[model samples]
Target: MAHHIWRRSLAVAAGTAALTVGAATAASAHHCYKVDWNPNAYANHMSGNTAWMPLSSMGAMIISAPAPDGAGLPQCASYASVAVDHWMAETGATSEPLIHSRATVGSGAAYQGKTVKPFAYLQDSDYAILEEGLGMAIDQCMADQGA
Candidate 1:
């Protein structure tokens, strides 16, 4: 079974509680696809913006949450997570149905004097797609950072 992050640091909770996820260890990713790319997004720059990311794990990926106010974000809060999950399922990541029936303003992390909220509900069923999304976002960040 793939191990995903059952719990992670929610830096964007504004001192709120961090999030808790449930998944297998086989698919546990140390570096979240979306978070890895946008380190300073939630706290410093885009607090309420969402970012799509590609991942190192094949077609897997991630999506960032909406940036907060006064973060000078690039993207706005949208249902990007749903789209990304669909993309992952299309590519054969997992069969778990994408459940966007509820609107979730999930938690974030505090990195680099900034708070970043994570958007995508990355799970085993959708790991591939989110990871791929993380990869995409990371690629974008690399270009932006000239890395």
Candidate 2:
């Protein structure tokens, strides 16, 4: 079940990264960015005060869910922040991460219109590494940003 995978991934992430997995209602620092589901594989850009992360629609919903307290923001913003940081560092990008300027021009666009796949249906163990990696990445990003 998706809940099982989510719990497992969270556990693995916490253990490996040694970071507390807090509620979706994160701090102000995590609110620095917003996510936009798009056709891009992975892309990020800063627009004014908000960092925008563009990913597949499914990916966006997974990370944008509200906290248990029903707050507007989610802790998964950390994941997006860390991912953007790594992409920037890996590509030596001072401003952008991907060459494509359009957010909805890839094959992923076909499925972008579908209703967000619920977390209960997102039960794929194969992607556990992604969750774990994002967890560690967030920790690293936090340290790098002095947050």
Candidate 3:
């Protein structure tokens, strides 16, 4: 009976150790910043030279290259624009109408001929509008892509 109890205690200790290690690993893997406006709850991985995120089933936002300053807001905005453009192209067929409407009326109005600054954009109400429009477009894009 003593031998069985010792074996059970050893097993419990090993299990506790494994659980601690697993929790640490998961915590470390969450190296992204969450976006409040994004309906998909996308998180921006701002580590290294490039900053990007995934948009649910729609697709991923991949920066072509890392910004010079690494974590500058302006650079992040620039990269975001590029990534959005790429997403637009990939989903053009299904998203053209929505994108065009936005360009003519809604969130796109704020973006016309304007350089995007991440901080300023976030502060603007137009940011939420743009996010909504973008979410719609992404949904259509995903449907078109058979995803």
Candidate closest to the true structure, highest TM-score: 2
Q: Estimate each model's TM-score.
A: 0.24, 0.30, 0.21
Cα-lDDT of candidate 1 = 0.31
Q: Considering every candidate listed, which one attains the maximal lDDT?
A: 2
Better of 1 and 2 by lDDT: 2
Candidate 3 backbone collisions, by pair = none
- For residues 1-147, write the lDDT of model 1, one tens digit per residue: 112111111221211110112112223332233333334442332332333223221222112322232111123113234435555557654422222221222333433444444334444545444434433443443334433
* Candidate 2 residue pairs in backbone clash: none
Cα lDDT of model 2 by residue, 1-147, tens digit: 676556545533443332222212222122122223253423323232223333222222334444322211244444554544454455443543221222222324325764433111111231343345455554553445444
- Ranked candidates (lDDT, high to low): 2, 1, 3
Of 1 and 3, which scores higher on lDDT?
Answer: 1
Better of 1 and 2 by TM-score: 2
What is the per-residue lDDT of model 3 for residues 1-147, given as tens digits with 9 covering 90 to 100? 676555444433332233233223322332222223342322223222223323211112111112221111221222233234443455442221111101112234345765433211222232233333343433333334334
What candidate 2 gets wrong by more than 4 Å, as runs, is 1-61, 66-73, 98-103, 106-133, 138-147
Global local distance difference test of model 3: 0.29
